[model samples]
Structures are given as structure tokens and as C-alpha cells.
Target: MKKIVLLLFFLAVIAQTAFAQVKKPTLMVIPADAWCMNNDYMTTYSAQGITMNVPDYKLALQNDIDLLNVITKIGELMAERGFPLKDLSSTIRSLEQSSAENEMLMSATSGASLAETPYEKLMSRAKADILIELVWKINTVGPKRSVTYTLRGLDAYTNKQIAAATGTGAPSISAETPVLLEEAVLSNMDNFASQLQMYFDDLQTNGREVSVEILTFDNGSGVNLESEFDGEMLTDIIDTWMYNHTVEHRYSVSDATENRMLLEQVRIPLFRENGMPMDTRNFVNNLRRDLRKAPYNIECKLLTKGLGKAVLVLGEK
Candidate 1:
């Protein structure tokens, strides 16, 4: 009996250790845009003579006590299930610091400034694999209050919704908002987590989805997609490279022209050959390097937007 008990204890310990070794996707919780708009936490920006409203995450985090409490509770619950969260406030602060530093630096050769859009700053700084958007409403009926909550898991790379859960909690006369929010999510958390796992599993199998566009600088280099190299059109060479480099030749040439080419649904490997995490910039830069070699002998400039889109301009930097 003593020997059987000791063997069982060792097996249990091994099982727990294995479970802990399993990798979980990194996640971050943010108030959904609807929640931000409804709560009056929004800011506007002008781009190309058009004004757009976007969620003011920094303002929301600083001003809303209930929002902080709800995010904390949800993060704690996720951490218990092996998925810890990237805190939004901390990421925002870090982004601000980096932005300030970038503003003070310029290229030594051209004296050009760092050009980054606000969206790029946020997405690059967050660095989470998944963004969990949370929205909740306090419903009061005759002094009894309940919370109607929605949680959506979005792939940070593709901005696609992979999982969602929505429901209302049982009404309570005295329970606080955080307690109600916790109760609402607890019932659906398991299924929501399962969906997230399914999405991650699909990523492991199919690779990450992104978009790549090929363009040319109008700098009179006499280079375009039709420009021939080694008896093959430049477009064909680029297409062949994409077929060979992308995961399993999974990408589509949505549009191709003399001056521009757009490739969508481009599936790239999750990691590079050296086992480092791969992003849009790294993936496109590989192509840029390849094009610079041997018969191609092309100089290319790479630009990336957010985490999933890259534009490569050929013929000159």
C-alpha cells in the first residue's frame, strides 16, 4: 500500500509539471470601442482632412474606477487558467516613452524623421498575441441591478474575432459592479477559453495571416513590375519568391499592376528560422534581402503598418 501511494504521488507531480510547461497565448484586456464611446472615453484625430474618433484607452484607464476593477477581476480569472494579461495602462505608458525618444532621433544620412502613425504605435507596443475586448452595461430594474457583459477575443496580428461570449448575470440588489461582472463571465469563461485554444491551434497548423504589397518609388529608376530580370518579369520573380517563402504557398495576388501589387491572405510562419517571433517587418525584410541578391540585384525599402501589413517598394530605398 505504501509503495502504490508513493508512485501515485510521483505521477501527480509529473502531471502538474507537464501542465505548467504547456504554453498559453499572451492576452491583454481592453475596453471595447463601444464601451469607450458609451463611457465618454474617446478622442479624435485628423488624417488626410478626415476626422475619426478612436478609443482613448489612456484616459479611460485613468478616469474610470469601475473599468479598472472589472479589468483586474477578469485578468485574475484568466491568469488562474494559465493566460496572464498584458496590462493596458503599462503598455500605454511605455509607448509614450518610446514615442518621445523617437521624436528626438533622425536619420544621419537624410535627416528624415521617424514616421509612425498612432495605430502603429499602439499595436507594436501592446505586443500581445490576443486582445480581449470587454464591454459591460449596468442594467437596473426597480433597484435590482445586473450586468450585461460581452467578451471578444481578437487575434492581435489579424484583428479577427476568434472567440466571443455574452450574457447577463442574475440580478442582485446589493452586489457591486465588479462582483456582477465576475459572475457573468464565470459561467461562460470555460467555453470562451476553449474557443481561444482552438484559434491558437489553427494558427499552429495554418500559420499567421498577414498582407503584403509591392510598390515602386516614382524616383525615375525605370523599374516596375514589368521590368525584366534574367528573362523573367519582375512580377513573376516576386510571385515565385512569395510562393516559395510563405508557409505552404498560402497567399493570393489580389491585384497586380505595373506599379503596384497587393498580396492578401498571406500566411507566414509564426517564428523565424532562429526561433524568434516573426512580425510583418521581419517577414517582408526577408523578401527585400532575397531581391537584393545575385540576378535580381534590386534595392528595396520596407514599410510596415501595425502587425500584419507590409509594403515593399522596389528599385530604391
Candidate 2:
């Protein structure tokens, strides 16, 4: 009997390992675009010819404490479904501290500021596989309040909409927005999570989508991607880098040129060594490090266009 019990336990262990191999995508929950726009938590940041309208999560939280609770509650709901979550509030705090450090260590630019939003900075450090966005409204009628919510799960690596859910809560005596939001989500949270999981499974077999581009600076010192490096053009060297670094060697070259290269369909690992998720920036950063080595000693700036595309501006100081 004991031998049979041990066999059962071993089989259970193997089953668990196989399930874990499937992997759950890490998540980052934040206020939805509509909520931010309504609250005016927005800022424009431009760099390297790319511009983005990003949210000020910290500012939104400052304006309303319930916003934090709303995000936290949504995260809790997702967490119950076995997904790991990065706290946007905590990420904002860390960014604030980092910003202070930057101010102390460096001088400010005199021209127009190009400061990115807290959401953008948070996106960089969290490196979550998906970004869960929440938008909720509380309606009061006849002494009862109900919450209507729209939840969306976007691919953190690609900015694609992978899942969406909308629901209305039962009217309750409590007029609290957070409570209403939680109640509304609980009604269909399981289905929402299932849809996200299905999408993640697809991303696992196929690869997460992303785009990569290489461009030479106009003020360059005449050294472009066509320059010879180790008997091969610098463009060829970068192509080799992508082929070697992409997960499972899966990627598609959309276009290539002496001074520009466009690569799409990049396959990247879902997580890093420290358990943080990986994204386009992390993949390009690796290439940047390689290019800084002895033969190619290239100077460049890494800019992200949306969540999925990485731009490496070559020859920019």
C-alpha cells in the first residue's frame, strides 16, 4: 500500500512540473487609458524621433486614493488566478526615488523637457508579460450604487489587445467605488483570466510579437551600418546578433539597408533571471552591449515605440 501511495505522489509531482512548464505570463495592473484621460494624468514624451502619450499613475493616485485601491483589487483578482503581478504603485514610488537621484547626480537640460510619464518608467522596470488596465464607473440610483467596469489585458511585449471584459455589478447599499468594482469583477473574473491564459499559451508556442529597427544618426561621424566590422558589414553583424539572440531563433526580417534595418516577429523569453518579465527593450539592450565591444564600439540610444518596438539609434552621442 505504501508503495502505491508513493507512486501516486510521484505522478502528481510530474504532473505539476509539466503544468509549470506551460508557464503563466507575469502581469502589471494599472489605471486604464480612459480613466487616465478623464483624470488628466497624461504627458507627452519624445525621444529619438518616437513620441508617446503616457499616463501619470502617481499623479492619478495623488488625486484619488481609491485609484490605488482599484488597481490593487484588480491585481488581487488576477493574482488569485495564478498570475504574478507587478504593483504599479510601488513601481511609481521607486521611480520617484530614482528621479530624485537623477536630479542630484546630473544637470538639467535647458531646452524643452522630455520627461516621460510614470507609467512609461514603470513599464520599463516591471517588464511584465501583460498589462491589465481597469476602467470603472460608479452609478447611484434610488439609494443604491452599482459599478460598471471594462477591463482589458494588453500584451506588455507588443501592446496588442489580448483580452477584454465588461460587466456591471449588482446594486448594493455601499456606495464605495472600489467595493463595486471588486464585486463587478468577481462576476466574470474567471472568464477574463481564461481568455488571457489562452492568449498566453498561443504566445508560448508561437513567439511574442515585437519589432526592431536600426538607424544611423544624421550627425554621425561618417560611420554607418555599412562600415566593415570584422570583414563583414555592420548591418550583417546586427543581423547575426538578432539571429543568435532571438528565442528559438525565430524572427522575420521586414527590410534591410546599409543604414537601416527593420526586423519583426521577434521571439523573446517571458522572464529574466530575477523573475521579472522580459520585453523588447531587454532584448535590444543585450544587442547594445554586444555592439559596445572591441571591434564594433558603437554608440547608440535605445528608444521604445509602444511596448513592442525597439529602436537603436546608431552613432548618436
Best by TM-score: 1
- Candidate 2 lDDT, tens digit per residue, 9-55? 99999999998777788898888988888878887777668888777
Give the lowest summed-lDDT range of ten residues in model 1.
108-117
Q: Which stretches of candidate 1 lie over 4 Å from their true place?
A: 1-22, 105-117
Give per-residue CA lDDT, model 1, range 105-206, as digits (tens). 886547887665565678788878899999999999998999999999999988999999999999999999999999989999989988988887777678
TM-score of each: 0.90, 0.78
Query: Alpha-carbon error at 306 in model 2, in Å?
Result: 6.5
lDDT of 1 at 230: 75
Q: Against the true structure, whose lDDT is highest? A: 1
